[model samples]
Target: MLTLASKLKRDDGGKAGRASGASDSTHRVSIRDRLLTKEVSELEAHLPSTCKASFPDEDKLHHFRLAVSPDEGYYQSGRFQFEIDVPEAYNMVPPKVRCLTRIWHPNITENGEICLSLLREHSIDGTGWAPTRTLKVHHLH
Candidate 1:
């Protein structure tokens, strides 16, 4: 569990930790934190019309919500939710993405696991999902 005060603590770069002479370890920020910040900032600035993101626990930067609603497709008007977890390795390792909304799709399972070529870690040719691949947050059709 997390609270707003703690969330702000890190968001503020632990200035208090420094002032209190706390060990440097407490103030260290990982690469994952920086990357997540950029991603979160970009998403907040230009989120797509059919998609939305919410941080239920700000402390858990790795987890977030992505709600999608296809405007023109078989799934049109249907609300679909996807929980995205960005691993620390990020570009080096693909995020663990799963559907939270139930739907009948060849690539998506009833249990919510998705099997998209791009989302998959490995392809038939033994190639892994490109680390440079763009993250999609809207129109999952």
Candidate 2:
């Protein structure tokens, strides 16, 4: 009963609706995927071979852990753990990294927050971070 143009409109509407839903889902997944992939790669490259890091959940890459066993120095023979929380912006912004292991270090605060130049995302002037500076996990300690 419907004309060709009307039938095409109906079909296009259904297709557009389905496509819109799929696009939204894909966008959300990609955000998490991109963050996790980038974080895992960066950790693997920067972390010492002795240390191990991974994302337990493929969907939730924002949370991860690292195990560090110092070969020498005051922390020698001690196994330390760290938790990393990467924000949505990630590489463009600094991630929140903290030591899960209780260690007494001049750079680390009693509350587990690291007081390092690179870990700080904001400048002393209260302005946003510089675009060129990409801080790494090792810089925290």
Candidate 3:
């Protein structure tokens, strides 16, 4: 859940608190964090009107909740919540997404498992996850 910005801030704090024994490993930022920093901005830019994203902890961009208020359809005017977690190996792997609200949807299970093709790690049809795909794929406008 750590972002590059937070990591940098933490590193700065560590310097002021302790000068020695701070290894380079402690400063290493994950690829997921760097990707989220950019992808998150893109997500906000083109976010659909029916959808809204919230990060409970502003410093953790990799973890957030997405609220979907469908304007039309069987679930029109109803709000659905989803939690997304981008793992450390992101881009190389798909972000983990789970439906927080209990709903009867074909693509989403009651237990929060999602069946989106892009969420899959492998697929014979080539619709599975790819490094090029970003967080924006979850909210197809």
Candidate 4:
């Protein structure tokens, strides 16, 4: 018998079992898709008539892109792109996010690792992480 974690690590029949099992993967995917769809819709509806968010591939629903044009700042005219990656444990944990576009900022490292409040590991011992908040990113400027 394979452990639950081990089963989830495999790519073939393993996925099928988990996809149909009682674990969070199945429900996670559905909830994530719905949340993402709703988020995209809301963003589309209220985005400053200039920005946009879209999924490049229909098959890979976990990945999407956002185009932002800061209203103020040195990057005002520059178009910034961000890639969002929704993990299988979504709502329970924040999505893994990184700036795909090259940027220079005190909080953003040269390698694209963002040093934000939410992204910070909670404990100095690295044994605990903060609970996921509803809205992860508010303002990047």
What are the TM-scores, per candidate, against the unseen true structure?
A: 0.76, 0.65, 0.81, 0.61
Tens digit of per-residue lDDT, candidate 1, span 1-141? 224455555667676757777667656667776676666665666766877777788777778888887788798999989898888777666777789888899988889987766666777865457866635442233
Global lDDT scores for all candidate models: 0.71, 0.62, 0.82, 0.58
The TM-score between candidate 4 and the true structure equals 0.61
User: How many residue pairs clash (N, CA or C atoms closer than 3 angstroms) in each of the candidate models, in the order given?
Assistant: 0, 0, 0, 0
For model 1 the local lDDT of residue 14 reads: 74
How well is each residue in 77-109 modelled by candidate 4, as lDDT tens digits?
Answer: 888777777776666666566777789978777
- All models, RMSD in angstroms: 3.9, 12.0, 3.8, 9.9
Candidates 1 and 3, the one with greater lDDT: 3
lDDT of 1 at 61: 70
Runs in model 2 deviating more than 4 A are 1-22, 29-36, 124-141
Best by TM-score: 3
Residue 100 lDDT, candidate 4, scale 0-100: 75
Which rank order by lDDT, best down to worst? 3, 1, 2, 4
- Tens digit of lDDT per residue, candidate 3, span 13-120? 866655576565555557787688778878877888988889988777888999999999999989999999988888888889999999998988879899887898
| Candidate 1 ranges beyond 4 A from true positions | 1-21, 125-127, 134-141
Better of 1 and 4 by TM-score: 1
Model 1 clash pairs are none
Q: What does candidate 2's lDDT look like per residue over 50-107, in tens digits?
A: 5777556544567767778888888888987878787777666777889888899997
